[model samples]
Target: MSAIMSGAISMGILAWIWANLSAAVGVSTWAGFMGTTTYYASGERFIKGWVKGMIANMVGVLWAIICVEVSKVLHVPNIVAIMTGVISFGIVAEAKWKNLSFVPGVYIGCSTTFGMLALNGTYLSTVVALLMGSVVGLLSDAGGELLVRLTNKKETEENLVEKQG
Candidate 1:
């Protein structure tokens, strides 16, 4: 499991982040996917990791419900539900790539889809959602590895010195 934040804790953070994000953007899907990725990446035992992931998502869904309730009060008329779901799913996809190369585009597409479409096509939203999910998983995995390097805090002046390209 990854370390910057422990597995369950990371899930909570992911949930919190996603919930807030969805509330702000009128979507809640991407939050749990990203949380699950962290659950896998975090340093828990394999079975424990899966359990944490499931539980974390259970809590996240509850949070989503809360967001839904709030939206009723705010009267924002969320057209972006699909976008939130897609981007939330994107969190799982980004887990595999730390550099997040595809993330920005996916986020835009996912976010826009929710904003604009009422009943989005399976052909388009589903495809984009899956692609975005994969992207997020990739990025999350890469991000963990990168954080490891960053936190090692190794080296001295020589390490900082630039090498010839």
Candidate 2:
């Protein structure tokens, strides 16, 4: 399906950019862009979904970075790196449980955020962003449900008319 294909394309694009683009800007921009694009395919829409998509990815990425940066500073062996990676993966899995945009953002942002977090340590900001992203996804799923109900009802009504006619 297009959803699978889009996910693939998003990953491919991320890889390519990582290889070629500047560390700070590219990661943030592409993660947000791809997250937004991929998030909508489930037919969900929130009043502020776009903002949610951006913040979720940006925050999720930063969270992953926190673990990596701390590990480097504390030099607590490679355990930090391993832990952060696992945590980031886990967060992504949680978000993806319903095919929400948060999953992609968290996955993509964490890898990028690791470096950013190393340099800046904006943990609070990242947390806030992730929360926003979660809200966006929640709204989108709710919206999708409403849309499905409306469409189905309309179809049933049309069929009833045809039958009666």
Best by lDDT: 2
Give me the runs in candidate 2 sitting further than 4 Å from their true place. Answer: 1-121
Q: What does candidate 1's lDDT look like per residue over 5-85, in tens digits? A: 533444455456655654564433553354344345434444454344334333333333444455556655563464356
Positional deviation of 85 in candidate 2, in angstroms? Answer: 8.4
How many clashes (backbone atoms < 3 Å, residues ≥3 apart in a chain or on different chains) does model 2 have?
Answer: 3
Go through the candidates in order and give the clash count of each: 35, 3
* Inter-residue clash pairs, candidate 2: 61-109, 61-110, 65-114
lDDT of each: 0.43, 0.52
Candidate 1 residue runs with Cα over 4 Å from true position = 1-121, 155-165
**Candidate 1: C-alpha lDDT:** 0.43
RMSD of each: 14.8, 9.5
TM-score for all predictions? 0.30, 0.41
